[model samples]
Target chain A: MTDPKTQTGSRQDEFEFFEESNALWWITLAPTTWAVHFVLAYGGTAVWCAKFGETQGVTVARLSIAGLTVLALGFIGWLGWRSVRRWKPRQNDMEDLSHPEGRHEFLGHAAFLLCIISAIGVVYVAMPALFITTCR
Target chain B: MIRSLAGSGRRLVAMALMMALAGCAGRQSALSPAGEDASWLHDLWIVMLVGAVILWTALNGLFFFVTRVRPNDWPERHANRLIIGGGVIFPTVLVGTLLAYGLSMMPHMRADGDGLVVKVRAEEWWWRVEYWPAGATAPIVTANEIRLPTGQRTELLLDANKYIHSFWVPALGGKMDMFPGRETRMTLRPETPGVYRGQCAEFCGPSHALMAFEAVILTPGDFAAWLEAEAAPAAPPATPEAQRGQTLFRDEGCGACHAVRGTEFDGLVGPDLTHLASRQSLGAGIMEVTREDLTDWIAHTRDIKPEVAMPAYDWLEAAELADLAAYLEGLK
Candidate 1:
């Protein structure tokens, strides 16, 4: 039989680990980065074309979009790498229900998967700039 | 029950086919493309339509097969394979291919930067046309009817004086928005000599439905001749009644909002009446340009088109109305 005080202390420790590591909150950064990149690329190109379409403005717009794509991909790759390192297989955990290391592992696995999907989404959105030479 | 469901599906498909066939013929139908730009758009539409039909049939066939024909005790690995292949891989390939194809065609849809330029300004319920010939000092101001030479690219500079409007000539090309204070451009090269109908695709105000125009694509010689005639002033009224009608037009304040070239009436508020009688339609393509229609339009302008800026002149005597219509009809 386990002491109730010991059980409460272990649960508190699990919650503390979850909060301090910020795994759950950081998972959303993948999609958030994709969304921000999409909006900036589309709006920047449209407004730039409307203002200065005939001159060197289109070159500037293309370069700016390329810079943003690289930055977003780099951030997502870093997050994915960090999550991959933290992720642990469920079999490695102790065969005890009260010890909840599985929860931390699950969070890491989800973050890693989400980051991959977000990176693919960003690339897909950037593909439009490759072929559309003009704003028309 | 299965037989009945199949019968209903057959009936639905038949009905859809009938409706599609019915929409194939019309003046404003994009399906009847008459120019290079429209031909490209039509080809794209056909490809997409064929792809959609195949996709829909395949998806429905898979659904039916899985539910009714497949064995219930299939292996778990098979089910997992189906989920990954049909759910993820198929959609990704399909959408990616479509996006690539659409992106490749974007640049080809725009103007090639070699053509004559025509400026079109969208008013509340009409169009103000200005011809900018090559190396001309000032643009030739015209209205409503746009005459383009067949087999030559013509670039249109579209702008708006008030609200947003869209310039759409279905047989020629795709629609481009006419934005106020900004100039947008579209190009069209008509392949045949015919009159195509155009309309303000954007809803501006109460009379939006009645705001229409015509694109007259003609032979090179005819187009040149027409342009020369349009550049000149209105021909003087020939008959006695027409001359009297011209006097009435000047005395009744019609000159305040309308302009007839080579005359003292140069109001810029309405369409130019330099060669009004030569046009095929009147009231912005709503009525034929006949003497009776003109008389009716003048007497009951508000009745024919509600909320138009032009007011009714019902108080004029019948003979005077006839004389005015004759004069306008002879301006060409």
Candidate 2:
């Protein structure tokens, strides 16, 4: 039988791996929100202009940039949510019992959860500013 | 007993401090004049506010009663009826009332009446006010400062030269934009005699934050005297220094941008310096028009305002600077 200490140590290592991966995944979501903001503002205006058959070259270019940005952000947000959804159950299972290495594993899981909560708060605060339209 | 008393005292102090901090904020906001139009739109704002308070109180009371009557451990009870009813009735009433009110108020605001009209043009930094008062000769042009008689209905015809800018004096009325090639009309009245300060609300450029002006609400007698003085051409300066400075002003390129009536300087690009001495402040209400400040402003316009279109007079000697200040002071 594997020693309880060694089993706990392995769980700690798994927890650390999950924590780092979670942080990295969430860091990638920031650029997506910024892109969504620009797309909503500039992209909406450009598409409306294009649908009316107005051939202004600069407007076309701005709209294309906005559309591409929105697509990129959507892709990144999907990837991040997918990874979090997959890893959350494993982290919860590890928290079922305490062992010699359980303390470190639990702490690492808490840190990763804190980061996710903080990221959600940041996005909520920035949503209004990013979506504000300044020009006609 | 002593520890509990001390704790209560500390809590009272904390509450008092919070109240004091709140009072300190927005003291200057009350100094503004008053809004122009009173309509149903304003009424809807009051109605919506009252409705929200009532709804919140009712819901909270119902929630408290239900929770107290039925414990959480009992068989699960659904609040779908309350949620669904509130979801439909709350937003529909709130938004619909506001939309109807706004639509009704828009037309009343646009209706023009037989009031004294003043044409106001917004340039890069300063406001050019033209008094087209009933039966006045060619509109009297002034900059930054506007003087009007109390208890008179005045219509402002606002126009912007370049970018979009907003004209707002919160005490009097809501903000109106000075859109390029479009004329916006705003009506205002001052019920009392006081000085009201206003600034450009829309972000225009680098100095946009600093762009400010004042509305001087004066008595009819003072307004008449001011108009008469403004109607007349600028009086010639008496002192030798002033005369010499007048000659210097002509020779220098100050004439190229600014206009001094009854002189060869007829450029209308800058502020009218015909009654330069009669003004309270200068530099678009940024600085007092003291002799020293005027001298510095004339010598280095770029120093006071970065990237200003007005060129600096680098060639003026000490004596010329002093004489010019004297001459400008004598314009009143």
Candidate 3:
């Protein structure tokens, strides 16, 4: 007999990202955004400070970090929204081990929380631009 | 034997404690802050340490409570809340606040000067210091010691001769780098009037550790008087030995690389010895500026401070060396 999941042709199969049930790779997604933001903040600050010095460099660095922080937060927020929905907010809905959604819900939940952490980290990276203006 | 071993162990612990306590109060200690910049840094360090202890204890306490007190697996919502609140939200908020607080102090720590300027050029293992009085046309040049007027912000312009060096007077202020051909400025407003110590924080060469200076913080009036005296020429040698030593100093080509004002000994390489006796220490704060120390230093330049630019005058007779030392001591 054919599997009921195949027979029903559920919408979940169409949206399935991975071939298997392992969604562990999703955990790295949030922290990676933080890492990228960190690199951009430091490298861009160095370049701007070197090129423009104390006068124009401060404004340029501040704007760049502000822009980066916004873009990074937006991306993480979107990911968190999708991940949290899959994670299932209701406590009673969390124990359905047989369902594929609940099977991967723990990973999604972790990724969502991590997205919040990464957004905070992005803000951390951008903090120096708020006060530091001199190359010396 | 057992009693002896115990006694030795106790002595060792006492010695370690004494060393640690001594480290906390010294002329070159960051803990003993004598300026606004260093005090802010010390405060930041203390608060960060306290925050670290609090976080560590709380996190460990949570673990202890969970595993020992309530071993059962927590409810789904409670577990999620615990992880999110403790791991993510709490740490982020605490650390972010601390980072902002530390960054905010930079602007104040690096505040602009209040008219006084000091140019310090870092050579291989010595400091070339110049004091520019307000409204003065030229700087009063000296070496190996920095004298500042207390209660006023002084702008220090730092540069290097051969390689990169760092100027740090920990009790007075923070450290800044000195780059060759590039001038980096830092400001310090000394609050305590005392003789502090400074050192080259960077490793440039063999005598890097020996490269140190005295940071003398004086009252404004005293500083002005000292500067006035410093700007004058070297006095005539009084004693007969000093007079003979001056002749030796000139004839022996010591003037080729060292400059002494009011004399034909004008050289551009080594430190200015115009007022050498008035300095706090000889050989870049390495030893006391005494006749004995000066004689030993001359006889053993490389041995005392390894790789110093000064050549050993070991060929001179004992009498001749004494005469030279007397002449140098008469500079004040």
lDDT of 2 by residue, B1-332 (tens): 99999999999999999987675333123223333442233354566677678767766766675678653543212454554455444544554554444455554455453456788778877777788878766888778777777666678889898878888665455668898899888776555566666678899887786667776767777887888888789999889999999999888878888888888888888888988788767777777778898889888887787666777776789889999999998988
Which candidate comes out best when scored by lDDT? 3
User: Clashing residue pairs, candidate 3?
Assistant: none
Q: Which candidate, 1 or 3, would have the higher DockQ against the true structure?
A: 3
Model 1 residue runs over 4 Å out of place are: A1-8, A15-21, A47-52, A74-113, B1-19, B71-76
The superposed Cα distance between candidate 3 and the true structure at residue B284, in angstroms, equals: 0.7
lDDT of 1 at A36: 98
B9: Cα error in model 3, Å:
12
- Model 3: how far is A70 from its true place, Å? 1.9
TM-score of each: 0.87, 0.60, 0.87
The per-prediction CA RMSD against the true structure, in angstroms, equals 4.2, 11.7, 4.1
Error of 2 at A98 (Å): 38
Q: What is candidate 3's CAPRI-style docking category based on DockQ?
A: medium
